[model samples]
Target: MSSRQGPVVHKFGGSVLADAAAFRRVSTIVHSEQQSGAFQHGALLVISACAGVTDRLLAIAQAAAAGKAEQAEQELQALEQQHLGLVTELGLDRGELQEYVRRLCAELAELCRGIAYLGELTLRTRDAVLGYGELLASAIVAELLRRELPVPVHLVDARRVLLTDYHFGNATPMIGESGYLLQKEGVTGALQRGEVVVTQGFIGATPSGIPTTLGRGGSDYSAAAFARALEARELQLWKDVPGICTADPRRFPEAQPVAEISYAELQELARFGSKVVHPHAISPAVSGEIPVRIRSVFAPQQPGTLVWHRRYDAPAQPLALAWRERCMAFRWYPKGNSPLAEMPEIVDTVRKVLELYVVAASQGSVLLVTGPSTGTLEELYGKVSFLPHQFVLACIVGNEPSRWTWEALELLRNSDAVSAVWTGVSPVALYVLLEESAAQSALAELHGWILHTHALQRLRL
Candidate 1:
């Protein structure tokens, strides 16, 4: 739509809202921001399901689909108790909130019964069942914020505003239509009245009113969409980690936090394999030119990574490293008189329907990689002859990756850990293929070399 008005959109994932105490922490953060005059027009909070709830829901759905109604019901009861227990722990009024939770659970129970009767779990039905996690979580969060904040806090069903296509498991938002409905449905009115609006993420509805999800880890994308629609001043993604790091800090404890990153660099990192943000989350923000702050709920005082159009005063060093393990590489060789012109079409098809990453391509042959989650290999069995081998895909992300390509390649070659290396996949990344046994060592060496080289460049400057 138009440019930013004033409101800031805040998104919290499951890791940040793992418990009742975490909810209190979130409420406090929102309240502090409000007190600090951070919500001028108002603030919109987008929330994902609590930790592990979506997985539990998926299990219940599978059980029901397999005709194990009793087992599904038991799991449903356990889930209901978990939410109700959160209410109890929060000391929230057990009157209407508890009843509301019970009502949602009852609806889920009905869906379980339906699946059991049909002995099938269609993608649409699974999307419907999965959406309850967000519905339940947002409801609880709204109630907590209502009790904790002095300002009027309103809970809105995101499905009423975020209209999407018919893709049940991984729906795409219709931005223009969704924006119109969002303002038409009173979200703008509530914000104008200085009210805090909270909504569920990762779930939307078709134009005909069927529930759909934005796929796994789609909450970040949901928040970005809302931010773009509302023209928010900034989108703050609150996570468990301190901020986006040079590498996954848990795996590489020496990984340093990046103070700033460009949208292109962050997108490259996410596409390669960073878990801090979803791969599709950046485009909406980029379209709006809105800055996104990757913050940590645990370390609210520390300034996190600011992703924007450009990085001011930041060196053009490798920003981060991302890797996908358990990857399968496929190589296709050109037959006698056959030109490899069709190779691009095959790669496009595989990329569209699966998690395909092209490592290298040439006139004589083509090499591609797919992650462990892609199970559609049979579809390409006879179409293009491919020899599959296990490998790891590692990428070094930077603003000017070409500047450091030779250094990275030389390091990889010297280490003798990487099996192959390729650039030009994107302007911001360099990809290297490694055997599973060598991936860890190669990555460690690359990370250390990047840090050391950056330090040397800074000293020379």
Candidate 2:
């Protein structure tokens, strides 16, 4: 039987796994964690597809579907060089690293070949092709861990361990079903025996062994699932930035780091659009009431942000300001004037047709969506979806949100650039739908009022 001891699940993002040097740095971090007895039960490392690798794989698939053989081959060669370059830089034996490199290259080639022959891309085939990225990345990370770390490195193919339904591209793992396999397959046994396990995040397999992905940025979700399956002590996400900040530092220069946050606030920030962490990344941890830490890969010494299950009273000020760009807003009218009770059906219909999510909803009419939008969604929405404005979603995420919620809505309503403004969906955060062209200036003015003017006190430790 698997031990019930709490383990540590560490998820490393693509930005932290870009090159050979990054892998070395992670190895050092892992070493320190082990030496400090951080993983009371054991450790499991979940890896992403490395920086820019996913985009490249998707491009290769697109080129293949478009019958751009030369371009596809060119991208393939570049990808090969990039992985092989890492192997060389890490000073690994060519034959050893080639074992992984050759297999992945061959698999990608066959998938691309099929796409070119078919002249189209299906969601199933898309996931099958993209799954190779994380598999190859995990293989490299495992080898690096073996050579650099002081523990036994075991590569546990997540496709074999993580059981999921046939959702293909954005599949959901059956955690309970996976628990049985984990015990029977020695995943838990190995952890109990003190081997450090390395697995590819975001990739899973159906009962028939077909490959699938848990959407982009699902590595964190994968780690959380693994942690829940094992009843781990805590989940740690290693990122490039210091931690979860008031706002994205790149977009908001004055954004401050949040030392700690509650699970409720974190989920609100994620659903309303905060890239610091994925929306479903901590689901398992939240279910088990496990603590999670978002720490910096570059600055390991920093404590970073901690998320707990405890409730914190709403402070008078908002916690942080958040923003999501390229949001698409849509308004719909039913066959007859409908009551708000029709929301569930409308939401179901929209979900059936598009990959986008409803971020803000009011009177069962307007929906603020943010996700991969395509011509397919456009065609479906063209039926009754009118206005279909594009905007930037900016909000103040906090315990007790400021009166600025109404104030900002009024401010944006008066702005010549803001075509529409939304309020009341979430009490803690105010949602604004800005005209695409004027989004920047509108965000600047709002930020200046709420943040720069000291209206909301900075949320920190």
* lDDT (C-alpha) at residue 24 in model 1: 93
- Model 1 residue 203 CA deviation (Å) reads 1.6
Instruction: Please write out the lDDT profile of model 1 over residues 242-297, one tens digit for every residue.
Output: 78888888888888777777877777777677878764765687677888888988
lDDT of each: 0.84, 0.76
Which pairs of residues collide in model 1? none
**Stretches of model 1 off by over 4 angstroms after superposition:** 1-4, 309-314, 324-356, 359-393, 409-414, 418-422, 432-442, 453-461
In the order shown, the candidates' Cα RMSDs to the true structure are 4.3, 5.9
Off by over 4 Å in 2: 1-5, 117-120, 271-273, 313-316, 323-394, 402-424, 430-461
Residue 403 lDDT, candidate 1, scale 0-100: 79
Tens-digit lDDT string for candidate 2 (134-206): 8888888888778776768788889888898898788888888787888887879878866788998988889
Pairs clashing within candidate 2: 319-398
